[model samples]
Target: MKAILIEKPGDESCMKLGETAPPALTPGSVRIRNVACGVNRADLLQRQGFYPPPAGASPILGLECAGRIAEAAADVTSFRAGERVIALLPGGGYAEESVVDAGSVLRLPDALDFETGAGAIETLLTVFLNVFQLGGLPSGGTVLVHGGGSGIGTTTIDLVKRAGGRVVATVGSDEKARRCRELGADAVANYRSEDWVEVAKQATGGRGVDVVLDSIGGSYLDGNLRALAEDGRLVLIGLMGGAKAELPLGALLSRRLSVIGSTLRTRSPSAKAAIVTAFQARFGADFAAGRIRPVIHRVFPLAEAPEAHRMLKASTHFGKVVLRVRDDER
Candidate 1:
């Protein structure tokens, strides 16, 4: 089977396509003929040797994939061979084939194509867990998303609207702000311009937002706390800007606010399974009914993964960038 191997990673140039032995089937796992794989910032980080796959995980970079089941382990009962599915992986999605835990495998809705499915799992699950599960976005409440044009950002916008919540988002450019609005964000602000915290306040009529999803961790942390409403929750999902930051403990004590941080890839298998189960039961019908949709920004052939990495690093694309292993699959 063909796979993207990071041979002692230094850059995207370190990622090479080469033939390797197909992954052998294991109990409680299923082999997928990967039709498409989603590229993530973590993948880029892994390529540069900043992140490594967890224990017992494939050394490859991808975190999620969509495809048909080639084989199912003996314990797998709910899913079968030849079934079309998409799955969350701890690692090892950037390949022609992959073996995923049956518990993490989900049957894609009939209405969704493989390309969209490839793009769906990581961002949607990440946003859902942090924004709604942890941040507690109640119906009719206001939520603010930083990096509004990012994969997680755009997905959070849709999820917030679907849950009957309002969204205020910060993007780097006017074009991205427009994209956020198109995804049903109630208000958009340019983070590169004036203070987005002030803009968010005005958007919410000075009430501030109930929840905030922030990936920029350095200078934005204090500002994110400032932008939160009384008793609001702030969920930090990434440290894209930088890790070190001076936080205002007084603000949290005075406003009674909470700040939480999470990453999906580093989670335990049971925890991931639980998250997937919750999402499945909550949104399965909506997905099948064609209400919630995956937002795909672009699709590149599997061999051009380095270009995809470059594009992700450029931070210009909105939504997810997928690598199509089989064009006909979608």
Candidate 2:
């Protein structure tokens, strides 16, 4: 199988398309003839050697793909060969084929093409797990989302609106702020030019937000806290800003705030299975009916993964940049 091979960690030049042995099937997992792969920041981290695959998982970089079942174990009763599916993989999605746990695969919406299917699964699951499940954002509640023009940010805005909640988002530019508002954010703040903490506070009529979905940790920690409503939960999903931060213990205790952090990659299969089940049960119908849809920024062929990484690192694209492994599959 051909994949995005890294010859040197931390160098974009190291990312080249090369052939490697296809992954062998796990006991309970099924094989997917991968059609498209979703590009994520984590893939960049893995390429740079900052992040490694979980124990016993494939060393390949991709975390998700959209494809058809090429092989299935006899024990896999719910899915079978030729089934159209979206796979949430531990790794190995940047290839022609991948092995994924049967429980981790979801039925791809009938009308959704593989590129959109590839873009949809991971971002949907990530936002659903962090903002709604962990952060406890209620219907009609107000939420603050950082990196509002990002793939996760745009997905969060749409999900929040559908759940009867309002969103206040922070972006890097006035133009991106407008884009976020057009995507259903009740308010948008330009963090590059203003104090986002104060912006978030004023946006909610001084009450602050009920929940915060933040990927920018480190220095933004204090500002995130300041933007939170009393008893609000801040779910930290990434440390894009840096890992270290000064703690505001007094403010945390006085305001009864909760700080929670999570990453989907290292979690056990069973744990991810639970998250997947919850998501499918809750949103599967909407997906099938196209009530919720994917937001794709661009599509690149699988061999041009290096260019995709460069695009993402430069922060020039909004929503997800996808890799079409097989043009005919979609």
Supply candidate 2's per-residue lDDT for 173. Answer: 86
TM-score for each model: 0.97, 0.97
Task: Tell me how candidate 1 scores on lDDT.
Answer: 0.87
Q: Please give the CA lDDT of all the candidate structures.
A: 0.87, 0.88
Model 2 stretches astray by more than 4 angstroms? none
RMSD of 1: 1.2
Model 1 segments more than 4 A misplaced: none
Candidate 2 per-residue lDDT over residues 32-62, each given as its tens digit = 9999999999998889899988898888889
Task: Evaluate model 1: give its TM-score.
Answer: 0.97
Report how far residue 307 has shifted in candidate 2, in Å: 0.8
Candidate with best lDDT:
2
lDDT of 2 at 223: 86
